[model samples]
Target: MITHTTQSVSKANIFLTCTDEKYYRDELIVEKNTVIRMISGEMKIILPDITYVIGAGDTIFFPRNDLAKVWKTGKDGRPYKSVAIYLTPEAMQQYAIKHHIKPIHPSPRTGIKCMAAHPLLDSLFNSLVPYFNLKNELPESLAEAKVDEAISILKLIDQEVFNTISNVEEPGKINLAEFMEKNFMFNMPMDKFGYLTGRSLTTFKRDFKKAFYTSPQKWLTQKRLALAHYQITEKKRRPVDVYLEVGFENLSHFSYAFKKQYGYAPSSI
Candidate 1:
């Protein structure tokens, strides 16, 4: 089986991720403001309307609580490798306080933001490489300092990053249909979907029924299957390739569902 692994270079949330698989994909919800620098190979990040492909030497930032689908690919006989630094809320808050920075108005939603080439950002990521060889975790104080330095650099380079850190607002209720349609492929739990869209579990179900005329689970399955069908027949993708991309958990369930929906096996397509 293809595998992906993450090793913490610092106990305070710096990580080194590696994968030898040619293509590995997964969906995630970012729990903290994360900065990732590609060390080798490439990565593709899929959002609702845009797809970003970054190769070695590129860096990208993901805002806290954002949902994203990612594909990592080994290239040129080299395994995919990247370093990620997670900026925790406590660290951000402490930095804001120390710098006397006040919370600002929340900015409009934007997906992942790519940083332009900058020596400081590049140096910060590269400097962490030696930590990977350390047998012991980097001290928490030093790790926090690294995180603070990253926040400081972000503040100087990207105003959006600074605003994201300063804004303390939670997600507000959004249009259920639009949000669900855009994010149905994420394969998240009902409660997570609700929370992301700023609704309670009860409200999400009721609103989903009203908007789609079906339960959330049913709507998601049908939507995922429909997309998978298109990919399989029109795009000439195989069942295994289409399954995870369209939100199904496993090949067996996807095949069963596809056959049920079309009265034929997807492999026959």
Candidate 2:
């Protein structure tokens, strides 16, 4: 079971220490304007468009009106432990608009591969752990000020670290052959798969081929066919079932792709 607390203030709402106890699957739902720090352990953020793996000593900020899910793997190789903080969209909107800051948007890809750390932003987030844990009587003005300070630090970091990447045109194709081999079992969207590793389709393909000398789509097809073959031969699952389960929308399409990649139709397996 997952345990957590939800608290609402005049201006913002927060969720602290939310996670599943068993450790196998843990998740936190974050609304807009939330700022999250990994107090300890490793956490992965899975979004519709991207995914990010946040380790200890890292902080992530979510601007207003975005939705996200955060997952943590287990400790002792058993289950994960985690804590989180949530802020309201209204509070963030008021502050950003009043201060003339462009609101933060959801990133298009996943992973920390592209983001560098800023010492100041890192320090500021580290300092907030105690307050987030305490959640005790804090002066509203002080609390608001602290949130604003965090936001300011994030803005500076964003300008320095994310602006250039965000503005650059994405590459045309991404190669996910190896990535698919490792993670294709998970039933996530293409964008989410791309995001979790912090690469847009174009960049993913470029880096993928550069690294593996193959294309992502082709790689994914090969992986699925291999998985299907394994399931048929070892797991005893039917070919049609495997095709649908591995994210194929159509059997004929799956067969065609399977044949193209493996030189044998899925049924032959």
Question: CA lDDT, every prediction?
Answer: 0.85, 0.54
lDDT of 2 by residue, 3-51 (tens): 4432223323333453334432323322234556555556776553467
RMSD to native, candidate 1? 1.9
127 Cα displacement, candidate 1 (Å): 1.7
Q: Work out the TM-score per prediction.
A: 0.92, 0.45
Clashes of 2: 19
- Predicted structure with the largest lDDT when compared to the true one: 1
Mind giving the per-residue lDDT tens digits that candidate 1 earns over 1-269? 46655433445689888888767877998877789999998898988778899999999989888989898888888888999998777777788898898766677744689989999998899888888887887888888888889999988988777778665567799998998888899988899999988999999999999998989988899999999999988999888877887898899999998899899999998
